[model samples]
Target: MRPPAPRRTTALLAGLGLLLAGCTTAGDDAGPGESGLLTGPGITETTISLGALTDLTGPYAALSTSIINAQQLAVDEINADGGICGRSLQMVVRDHGYDVQQALGAYTEIAPSVAAMPQLLGSPMLAALLDDLAADQMLTFPQSWDSTLLGRPEIQVPGNTYDVDMINAVDYLLRSSLVAEGDAIGHVFFENEYGENALSGSTFAAEREGLTIVEQRVMPTDQDMSAQVTALREAGVTAVLFSAGPAQTASFVGVAAASGWEVPVIGSTPAYASQLLETAAAPALEGLFVMVSGAPAASSDIPGVRELVESYQSAYPGESIDGGVLSGYGVMEFLAEALRIACDQGDLSRAGIIAAHRTQGLVEGDLGMAMDFSDPNRPPSFDSYLLRPEVGADGGLVEIESASRAPAVDDYTFPTSG
Candidate 1:
């Protein structure tokens, strides 16, 4: 039997509508500021507009909606704190439905108007828009952590790349004695950049540990995991590494449980959704582990996380949230710091934003791992948090391990720009 979905109150939904409508402002015809600070697109004398290319009506809509709400909250808080550099922050949001074409169109429409984008979700969509982003010199913070997005002056990934995340997952399993050397583990992933990138990490870790990986590549549209599970079981895999969406994770784990395959399953951050706890797969998911960049928002002991939870609850009253809320809030805060730096340097142009980001030395905040944003050629951080699902937990997940970089990651070579 499945549990009921979390309660998303009507007031919460209405709040989201109001936030979107309020934040979506058109670019103004105003020019440079009176303070002698050079200004560019998205920045007027009174406001600084940022773009949010997100997904609200697609496979990851639940997560994206939480992210958007958190972002709105961050904007509200920043604006209330006297704004940045004498200008209020305004977010121009556009939902792309996780479609590449739609994302490109949205970027095209907003790129000329906004100074930068704080939230560009979807690996495939970001991959498609890379060239356009570079041409416009738009400073963007992608929600994805694909290695291919690294080393780009215009794009900044907030945490460990997908490959690094998978490597850490494998290390966690091996160290915890969940899997042994010379055993075979199954890897089920999408054929897209996100999945392929994760596969590289698993492949590297398997080779180093003398373990074998049985691969199962699936399309984004693939849902049922009976065939993949059957293949892995036949291959005698001792464990499973999953790098698909939440739906695939539930299906794989549910199917495995029904078939009596009790192997441990480790998945990337995107693979689990809190709402999955409501399904029949809930019991099966209790054994699943997820790798992420930061501690779960709902249960972290960090002071910032506590403040975020209090503020969110106070604002929305009865809305249920997930890790995306913390992620959204953290990424937006990172961008705000960069804007502060740019403002201090007397430049708020798009180029100025990128330059300011490169100067960020060590970033420590309430929502994520400590990262050094000083270099564009390397990942900001290699640490990952291991989490397990718990039904009564605030976000349906609890941190089993805090942020740590695996020893194997030290030897792994990150790919550089071509």
Candidate 2:
């Protein structure tokens, strides 16, 4: 049976609401940074520093390491090519060891010393430091996608943070699939706040589609998942929307397929990363569906795409390129644009960088989607695409097929970089 017309409107709202434009915390006027070119109060003789917090020792190490490499690649590339402004970028790295208090201590240490903060990565850790960063006036470049971080999930934000990831794969199911009231959709989410935010959207989206969700399974970051998979199978779920990373995602897919639980799987952007899937064994994730807010690996058609690819390969020899590389490139794109804007405006201030991003929308020549930080918007990305993760003859996520028609730039509205 066809979905009713009224349900279509609700689905659209769900999609828009999930886009997470300024949905988290209260919107702030993010001022610019201190530029060496400006001979003023904030300007200093030392190198302009951009620090980041890493879970270099914890369960999230693989992705965390990737995030750090990606961010650092941007930093190293910028520094090599005359750096951000005339001042070189000094990376102040800290390891959180998967501990929130450790992460906070690192944040506290970096807050006063650096011009900007670690576009902080990881779920609970980043959310844990949200209020401190806001109160201390540190610019952040976060790598986590947990929408609840905008409000409250597990690690309560001192205040509402903008939840950009309020939408994920579930949006597609509600709008495109045939889920009805009698059918139950099974969901599994990580215990972290980001995982909850990602999974909760699935629940709400399933309900909006007139579907009854019977089983909700939650797992800690380090727990084994054989039981969760078995439980979902017993529950008679017709489909699944998940909040897991590549590793757990792989485990679920492998077990689901082997156990004859053959439901089509759908997940947020994190599930789509090629490196993550590859790390988890490429063949294990074949035939899975994923939705994320960026284009596939850097395409050749995009300007500067080749340079980025070459730079990434050169930096990490023998390591296969992953989807996370685009993010590494984007951070630099923002940093460089901020520098250019600071130069043109004759000052490097936090507000200046915000003005640059808001005014001169820097079209991502390489990373696919342009980063947007508009006057009323702070969720820097919303360009999402859908794909099926099928293994090629080469044993990799060989061929990608985009489920959407919008180009990377057209997918999102960038702030004017005037």
Candidate 3:
């Protein structure tokens, strides 16, 4: 289906409404006047629409729900601030159930109404939509940080990839003396691109530190990892790097605890879900370390993070915020910045947005890291936040900082392929 005519739609909106510019009222001239920059399917004289593709009813729902809430919070704030280029932002959200086919269908339906997709939930979903997004010239902000997603012209990753994250994790462990020179490091990861990327990093780091790397691969469908834990235990691995989902992570930890093996376990960001604290494995997760591309929600050092947490508390008093919410907030904040830059460049269209992205040298994100989206292939940040799960006052995983390994891991190039 073809999108509506940009000029006709802009004219219709302008003819139907006129208020104060930037005054929350629409026609008044309190801010920048209408610069006639509305020239896209989802852009109008006073509004710009963004789409959010999420997993609201599948394995990742717990994380995606918080992400959606935080994204809406960002949209609300953008609208309240009189919008960008005198245009209020609107989010068109859809649940994909973490299915590729469903995500493809949902994308087709919402593509015409959105200038860009600021949030696409999973690595698999993004993979399915890559061709369509490229053909349409739509800018995509994918949630996954896979190394293979790099070099795509239309896709933007907000943080370090799993590969770099693992490198940082290994570097931290070695430097902190959690593992010594001759000790073996075990890696348990999904038998897919995500795990492959993570293993690449660990392998590289292991080679550098003269440590042996032992790997255990599992299918995504497999839930129990007692066998793998047994293998690692027998291998005498001093530290374990996990690149699996929350359930798999819990399985590894729980199985290890049951077997009375107490080696240090480190995981990628997705490995630690807030839901884990409620599971039967909650006790086993204590002191588990995970690496995050962004800062924890509890970190009040970043002004944007502090404001987001405070707002979340007031807006959803009954609900609790977590790391997922912070990740979502960071992504949206990056999108908002890109939109503003596009508006400044006088090209809110898809092509214009991509062009503006290249010119954007450095974007300071609320994720506690600065991003550089000028190159599509390169990750925005190589820095990672090392977090240890502790029982917070709320009885959930409170991510406490362990180390910052950016200085050591910064120069390491993420492998091109998984």
Candidate 4:
């Protein structure tokens, strides 16, 4: 089915309008007034500082950089428009190098210095810091979409979890007749929360679609997936769903091709990395599909998306806009809504921001869909777009289908162990 002409959802228009409004003279330049309420740390009379603990020099460095850039763009724009509640929004970033101990140390050092943390990069690292964060009632914008984070009110993941992505991917395959009922479907996962989250969805789909799921788990450090691909092929699987990193993605596709195991390969969001397109495995990745929660950066039909693309292009001329960049931009939009609501309530503190997030039920912006925070424990959206890879001068993953929402996803319970 063809996707309808992209409608400028109210959320999209409102998000851009709010950002543009910041550029106008609408907010109170006097900043949040002294209400004597215990606002969280990091808010001064003139500025609201946000901390970002990232993986700048780690395995996921490229992704971390994109997110940082997007967040910076939002901050710059917000600051130019007079900032939130009359105070400049500043982000204090720390690179943890994807090490849990370093991440904990970074959080310890910066915990007392910010009003909120809008970017906590690693799942394991974030998990290690959760206790400390909760003790201080600190609000965080985590990068991982693991369902476990949903239980923490202070941690808000901007997009759906890996489980939701798999559910939709499976549904797409079945609906499109690429796979039949009872066909053997294999899953190559990382064996961690990120991988398991995706497996949970695929498992759910299998139970509903009557497909057999052959599981193959790998460690986060595993770079070669030849053995796994060989096993899946022997099992006579009709397709493979992946929940691993970029290197693993390349390895799986390249190795599969070398072994002559041709099957539709679908990956969760984290499985995609534009950098893979430049690798020796690039040719092997042709025709591979991945799930994307938001509209791609290439889709300029939405006004907010257009603004983001233009901003990124001008700022980083010639740089590729990938999912990481798009995700980072989305995060800021989510933060902006929460901050705006808090400022309106005359409380720019950490507690104030949390309260604002809970009350700001549905926020429509350029992020993806209208995000609803009415229940922080639930996913913001269960739908996704299916993207297929095309190599060469005009190569990139193009959206072949939009608005693919699976019933299995909608019915799947949150915080399930896989």
Candidate 5:
């Protein structure tokens, strides 16, 4: 039998997993990398700084600011602990305003200070910089769940959907009465290039299970979708997969729920933010099934899950970490791990960071999985699980464990190629 993970190794892996999965707990209140005498228990160096660009002031404000704050808290914790190789942790933040031009400007200005640039948490913006980020050797912690870029641009993606979570949810639905064995799964996705890949992944997975796409409704990313939802209901779709952001998802799912449609709402990871369930309301979001790439459905049960949760709570008192915060924390934690490995390898080089990301295993961290970006064929989690939304006591969402789903990711052996 495999030996139990060593304690130190487990702690290390826990740290790595939290950073990668953005599991910034309320209790992780370490200040900055400590100084020789100006040290906190975890504090280490004085002033080491990395950069992050976020949608803090824009349309996605629902989760962006909280995410940045969580990332900052993680950095402060590492710095307090005498950060990687004695360098203090500092996070230089840039607000993207959820706009592409602003993101480009922020990206251009902060390109040189840090070892690598973590991408903003938006699809349109990330897509705008795929080639530029790769060209600059700027590695990123996965944010957008779009996986189409995996084989096309060679950009880094750690928690993407096709290879991460949604496929299995679609597979499970296929085996259920939701869809007839030979029937195709219908989809109502945003009609943008970014949302296309999500729909494609569902199609690929559905086909793998002998299901087809019988009716697909493509709508604009930000349009009012009463018509689209109506159309899907009229199509007589048994089940549907939504590939848009929170707003459109709420619109479609809410309408479907109100119209007495019994279709199980399937969603991309982006639409799985815990806030969405509440904002979308019951009748609309009840029994909504969202597949995710990180953390178990009920994270509070995982070993350090509660710790991270409380850490976030303490750090940002009165703040709540809905589903999106988890993603934010996961990505930040992973980036820290890569940075730690980069320092361990002597120099803070991107190549060294990438190497560390590949060689490391669970080490007993939150995501409870290993991440390997050493190959190009796969840029995201080679596997993922499903998260069902169950109404909690306060009439809020509780990601339920209706099923444990993950795809048979057999392509890890595929070479990392563009």
Candidate 6:
């Protein structure tokens, strides 16, 4: 069972204020006077520093690059608009290269200086640092969406968890008649929290729909999917659910096509990369589908989405755009809201920031869904958009279904942090 939520008592606040006061000298600028905003490590008189622990040189480089760029764009815009709480927002980024060890080292180096982290990528990395993060009371938005990371006040998942997305994927497949009762389904996944969490959903769906799941677990370092595909083909699966990185996606699709296994392939959001459209696997991706939390980056229907896309295109003329841009920008918007609320209460300290975040009842932003941040134990949103790969479409994906939550999600039990 999870522990009780931390109380924001006057004594707790006072202690944190005193501790922070000693950290910043009196020569520093005054706090926001009206609210008695007590300044903390990342908050000075003129700037509020946030940390970004991202993957820039590893398997997720392409997506992480786009995410970081979007975050930078958000920061620039926030600063341009006279900043937040009379102070400019500064994002300090460190590349973890998708390695757990490197991620830990980067967090250690930056945790002392930043008040909060708006972007920390990778499930394994976040799991490794979960205890420390709680101890530090660092409000973090992890790029990973595993259910096991839930029930922690300091860690906020930006969108639906992997299990929730998988449940939705299964629901969509069943509703579309891609798979039927008693049909075998192949589940290709990594041997980690990410894949395991997704597997939980698939298993639940299979039980509900009278289907069988043929599970094939692979490590992140495993790229070739020949063996897995052959096994799935032997199992005579009518549909496939994949929860892995882009490399595995490309390989799995390519091998399936070569083997003449013409089944509908559905993957989690991180499973596809825009660069794959330029590869031999591009043709094979025609049978591929993905479940994501946000709309396409170039979507123009929503006013907020359109504005972000226009600003991004104008600011970065030649850079490629993807759904990561939406995620990066949206997370920053979420963080900025918490900061603004904290500033209003005159408490920029770490504990104060966490306290402020809990008060955000319904956070409506340019993102696809309305997030309820009031309950930190629950996921922010449980909706997903189903998209398919297209050769020339923006972000190499075309939305087949808008954002919607599956009925099964209402019965799904989310895992608590251990």
* 1-418: candidate 3 lDDT, tens digit per residue: 0111111111122311122111221111122336644356677777888999999999989888888887888788777777777889899999999999999899989988788887898888887888788878788888788888888767887678898888888877877799989889999998877888889888888887799999899877889988999899899899899998888999989888877887788888877776677777877788454545455545445565666677777766867667777777777776776677667655677766655555555666544656667667688677677666655523144445533554546566756532
Assess candidate 4 and give its lDDT: 0.73
Task: Please write out the lDDT profile of model 2 over residues 277-356, one tens digit for every residue.
Answer: 44443555665544344445444334455566666667877655555565555554555564555556554444333333
Cα displacement (Å) at residue 113, model 3: 1.7
Order of the predicted models by TM-score, top scorer first: 1, 6, 4, 3, 5, 2
Score each candidate by Cα lDDT.
Answer: 0.80, 0.52, 0.73, 0.73, 0.57, 0.80
Worst 10 residues of 1 by lDDT: 1-10
lDDT, residue 172, model 5? 60
Q: Which stretches of candidate 3 lie over 4 Å from their true place?
A: 1-38, 297-301, 393-403, 406-411
Give the per-residue lDDT digits (tens) of candidate 1, residues 137-163. Answer: 788888887887877978998788889
Single out the weakest 10-residue window by summed lDDT for candidate 3. 1-10
Q: RMSD per prediction, one decimal? A: 9.0, 10.2, 8.5, 6.6, 8.1, 5.9
lDDT measured at residue 390 in model 6 versus the true structure, 0 to 100: 82
Model 4 agreement with the true structure over 99-216: per-residue lDDT tens digits: 9999988888988878778899887897788878776667788888787678676778777778888888888889878899979899999888788888888898899889989999
- TM-score of candidate 1 against the unseen true structure: 0.91
By the lDDT metric, which is better: model 3 or model 6? 6
- TM-score for each candidate, following the candidate numbering: 0.91, 0.74, 0.87, 0.88, 0.79, 0.90
lDDT winner between 1 and 4, please give it.
1
Error of 5 at 195 (Å): 1.6
What is the per-residue lDDT of model 6 for residues 118-148, given as tens digits with 9 covering 90 to 100? 9999888998999888888889999888888
Error of 5 at 324 (Å): 3.0
